[model samples]
Target: MHGANIVLNGCSDRGRLDQRAAELRSAHGVECLGLFANLTEPGEVDECYRQIFARFKRLDVLVNNAGILQDALLGMIPTDMVDRTFRINTFAAIYNLQQASRLMTRNRSGAIVNITSIIGTNGNQGQAVYAASKAALIGLTLSSAKELASRNIRVNAVAPGFIDTDMTRNLPEGKFQERMNSIGMGRIGQPDDIANAILFLASDLSAYITGQVLGVDGGMLI
Candidate 1:
């Protein structure tokens, strides 16, 4: 195992999740710096990156994994809900990429993995805004990859389906089960499933791959 030191930004909120992550890091002997930042705010992002640069002096990987979903049909969705979803899910990724790419271009080597969703590729009812935000991320991934490829920066995305996370746990059990049955694997995915794909994208194993959307959905996208 490479004792790769990492700064995990955006882990400060949500009931002190950073505390638990820090505990795990201590147990594993990994240097994990957790910072608090509201990703939707540019000023917070800037400050977070400044802290990272001040400490690490270099950034090798950026995982744009912070996202929110407001599920409502387009006609029924409130303007505020749509705007908030885009601000956090889509725009935040772009803003992070803007800063991350600048640092990466200087190093001429970095990897960016955006967390997307299968709903982005295959539209779903009552998830218009969420889907749209993720779809925008896919586009951003491709465009950023093309622009950063010459600099040796790889930009890619992972589209997850029916993942068993706190977000999905809030769904009605019956509805969640129904969705799981549609997956070819006959089960929901885990966060590690997406995380593993992210690890690969960040590792040298995927050195030649870029501008790709690796679907971690059990054949759901097909």
Candidate 2:
């Protein structure tokens, strides 16, 4: 069971985003604080940091898991959709990393796990914008790892493929099934599968791992 004091940012008002995280913390006897910060807005992100710092005085790990998808073929993709996706998926993570890493540097030890996607590594047909944004995050993960390693901070990413969450459930059944069958495992992944990997990267077990992208995709890429 995990017994770490954790903060969940970029959570939604209805608490859906952090429901599983909170449950996991309770089951594991860990202290979990949920912050409903809209990562797309800088002001909200800063306020969320203020609250977390005010309560905990320090942060040990940061998981940038907030993201959005606007799926359309490149020609059909709206300019505004592309802009919004980049704003939330890419810019938000960068801003949070900047602020959170500053705190981690003071302490000289921390782990930052970013949630990317397989689409990022192998571009998908209708997800050009989303994939591009996630690809940028992977790049950021590597560069930040180099920049922060000297401070004893580790930066890494997890790229999940066809995870079964509300986001995927909302997709058309035929599309979802087609995607799942494409994977060698012949099934979609559960959120816990990805969450467990996140827990590992956040814990000391992965202390030696950094600047790496761990794919939790059931051999989809292979």
Candidate 3:
């Protein structure tokens, strides 16, 4: 959709990926390649990048959107929950960015977007570890931006508020209204809202923007 050949990386859902790839080809004539890899595995990450380069030969944009949320309060939080959250959300993102930056630096031009959460910006109850892991990405975004800028790679983050997704829908009914009240818009955010912000950061429209966390929360903090 953005005039760049897209390679979507996912850990599973091959059937869905194939369907979307066919849809993109049929609707927009876009060549979309979907690859599945366990992003938490360093070896898998490396192989995924190897496949990407073999096919695309170059990398331009990276959207680090893979994450998992397991909500639990401080004392009751399971150790394994923390490990899974950090592995999927923080570590895997670093692995992907590390690989993507290497390829982009060769061309001296690229954009990277990390999808964080509004809860990361303003911590919420029962999400201590989840928030912490996401906060790490903000630090990663800023630091990576400085390190990669000289190489002509831009790094940014998008913090989404309460969005209508299966993940959020699973939250307790009380949480739903609690989030709505927090947002000045008084409405739940749509996935497209986050996509638009990422697109801006990934495109030339934000050529001069980097090392920044854009909140796509419908004024949730305000």
Candidate 4:
């Protein structure tokens, strides 16, 4: 932990968001704020950042980690599912960057780390839409990095492998084992694994690093 003092989770579900914020406060004694916004809405995203700026006075680091997994094989995939996936994964990141960079550019120094998935780079079976969204995010990172470099803003992304989240936990038994075996380390990643990676990229230690993608996949792709 960077001792950031403030931990915010941007989610539409205020109940769960508040609960997670409370947990952060109770566990680490850190002040966490829950901001509820339909991120797909550009105005809402702008308003959310306004609230953050009002509280924090300035923005330093932003981790665009909000996403969803709507897994239905292409062709049969629901149209709504495709729309939702891109809206949350790709378009929302762009919106957030627009707002975050607006604030960060004022300070002329900040780091933006987007949470892309391994599927983004590797292309999964039932995740074509998800992959495309994340792939677009990667493009966004590179362009934003170049555009904001003059402002001393650094942009990067982390592509996480099969981490043990609720989303990845319910794979059929055979599918689970298949994924487990694919990991060279023979273990699915933990949230901390990805968090540590993000910290490294966001911290001053990586002062010269920008417009890059760090794959925290435990050798899954290899």
Candidate 5:
């Protein structure tokens, strides 16, 4: 893998952010810039992109990984919660892709990887809002990939299934076991599993690929 300099944008914890950046620098010998911003706001997202271009003068890859979950049954979900979930998970990616595509188009090349979810592909009972938001992202990925293909910009998505992250860890033990039972792999996926797939789509390995959604589910969708 290329040891590329990266911008850790929108990270709020300065202490932890700096600590991790130092670790990356020391371990991987890569430059890391930690910029704090609110992605749900278009202005803030724009500002973050502006800083990236101002410093690096170019953008080779864009990964839309910021998302929030507001799970509830469709009938009981509040209107505000639905709006907020879409605003952050769907609209925010659109805003960033618009800006990133602009920069990537200028260079005539770039890769964009959106972090979607398998729930987007197969609807979940209590995750109607979250699934809808992620589904929107998949649509964006396809449309953007087609629109930007002429400019040599590739747009794709990674749909992870119940990865073991801070969010998934919050599930009760019984519910977690049920989730594991649902997966054919019979084990929870780690964050690195998703990260590796993102890296593949972001790299030349998938240079010929676009408008595709790679499911990183542990055979859950199979």
Candidate 6:
């Protein structure tokens, strides 16, 4: 908990966001603003940015952590599912970065962390759509980092390896065990493990780092 002012965007569940905001406020004394936006819509994204800037005036760090999984074999994957995956996972980040970078470059300093996946690099059996989207995001992180470096804006990615989030927990038990067994650590990575990596990338500690993907996957790639 860095105790910074936080604006959460693109949430459709206002009640849950509000409850989480209240909890964060009570625990860390941090101000949290929850805003709703259909991230797939460019106009909604612009409106969300307007609200964020109007309220906070400045954005120190942005974490592009929104994504969806439509797991299907490459041949079995539907056209719409692939499009939807990219719509939320890849295009949404591009749109958000367009708005965010304009502000960050104006100030000449900021950090952006994109949440990716190990599947992007290593590939998986039934994750063609998800993997392609994440792979695209990794490309975006690198290209954006170089493009924005002159303005003192840093862009990096965190590739979580089978982290224990809502997405992973819902996997079939047998598949989950197989994945866990493959991990060198022999355990699922907790959410905080990834959060800590993002925190470092977003902080002054990583001032010299840019255009890199830090894997928080309990040695899955190794």
Q: Top TM-score: which candidate number? A: 3
lDDT of 1 by residue, 88-134 (tens): 99988998999998888788999999999999988898998899999
Model 2 TM: 0.89
> All models: lDDT?
0.87, 0.87, 0.90, 0.88, 0.90, 0.88
Better of 1 and 4 by TM-score: 1
- Candidate 6 collision pairs: none
- Candidate 3 vs 6: which has more lDDT: 3
**Order of models, best TM-score first:** 3, 6, 5, 1, 4, 2
Better by TM-score, candidate 2 or 1 = 1
**Residue 97 displacement (Å), model 6:** 1.0
Give the alpha carbon lDDT tens digit for every residue of 1-222 in model 2: 246676776454646647866786878777777777777788888888888788888888999888898789978988899899999899999989988998888789999999999999999888899999999999999999999999989999999998988899998989877787788987789999999999999889999999999999987752
Tens digits of per-residue lDDT, candidate 6, 110-146, equal 9999999999878888897888899999999999999
Q: Model 6 compared with the native: what TM-score?
A: 0.95
Clash numbers, per candidate: 0, 0, 0, 0, 0, 0
Q: What residue pairs clash in candidate 4, if any at all?
A: none
lDDT of 3 by residue, 1-222 (tens): 356777877667888887887777677777788887899999999999999899988999999999988889889999899999999999999999999999998899999999998888889888899999999999999999999999889999999998999988987889777778988888899999889999999999999999999999888862
The lDDT, on a scale of 0 to 1, for candidate 1 is 0.87
In model 3, the Cα lDDT at residue 130 comes to: 91
Candidate 2 accuracy as lDDT? 0.87
Give one digit per residue, the lDDT tens place, for model 4 in 1-222.
Answer: 446756475565788888888988888876787888888999988888888888886788889998988777879888888899999998989998888888888898999999998898889998888899899889999999999999999999999998999988888899888888899888999999999999998889898999999999999952
**139 in model 6: Cα distance from truth in Å?**
0.7
- Segments of candidate 2 deviating more than 4 angstroms: 10-30
